[model samples]
Target: AQSVAQPEDQVNVAEGNPLTVKCTYSVSGNPYLFWYVQYPNRGLQFLLKYITGDNLVKGSYGFEAEFNKSQTSFHLKKPSALVSDSALYFCAVRDSRRSNDYKLSFGAGTTVTVRA
Candidate 1:
């Protein structure tokens, strides 16, 4: 089984400041991790993913995350925060070894408030 956790319910950041949303995951086998963002009243959009190789993975909207094997973490980060970046974020995970299972378990969403 795979599971994900987003410990913080909300993250407040000032515009132009760095922004981060924490996520942790666990799986019996190799884990596939993903980050998604949702604007108000909008469906979730894929931001990034970690399938293999490279500890640091970059994604759309100038965001990135580092995969930490020891820590079992994949935290989303942006060098600068924008008011427009305010949104709900989610972390998801799947067990890669379960080829027959495509189910993804998700963490409780984190709301990011980037203030101007």
Candidate 2:
């Protein structure tokens, strides 16, 4: 089965410091990985994705992720954390070979707290 796992329940970091949220996946075929962030009372916003190209992919808010095929991991990274960045993060995956009925499997979610 295709799924994503986020080992951490929460991540705490001081403002202006680098932050990372780890994620790993299991899929039958090639995977389309994605990172999403959600604030209070709002839907998730797309951060980045690893489709078919380079390993390192950049996304909104100066965030980036590195796709490690060997490790089956895609970890989200940011050079500097902001208080506003405090939110819920989710890692998701979709099997490219699957049909449209295949929905994205998401992690339970990690809460990022950027302390000022």
Cα lDDT of model 2 by residue, 1-116, tens digit: 89999999999999999999999999999999999999999999999999988999999999999999999999999999999999999999999889767699999999999999
For every model shown, what is its TM-score relative to the native structure? Answer: 0.98, 0.97
What are the lDDT scores of the predictions, listed in order?
0.95, 0.97
Show model 1 residue runs off by greater than 4 Å: none
In model 1, the clashing pairs are none
**Ten residues in a row with the worst lDDT in model 2?**
94-103
TM-score top scorer: 1
Per the 3 Å backbone cut-off, how many clashing residue pairs does candidate 1 have? 0
Candidate 1 structure quality by residue, lDDT tens digits, 31-112: 8999999998899999999999999999999999999999999999999999999999999999999898689899999999
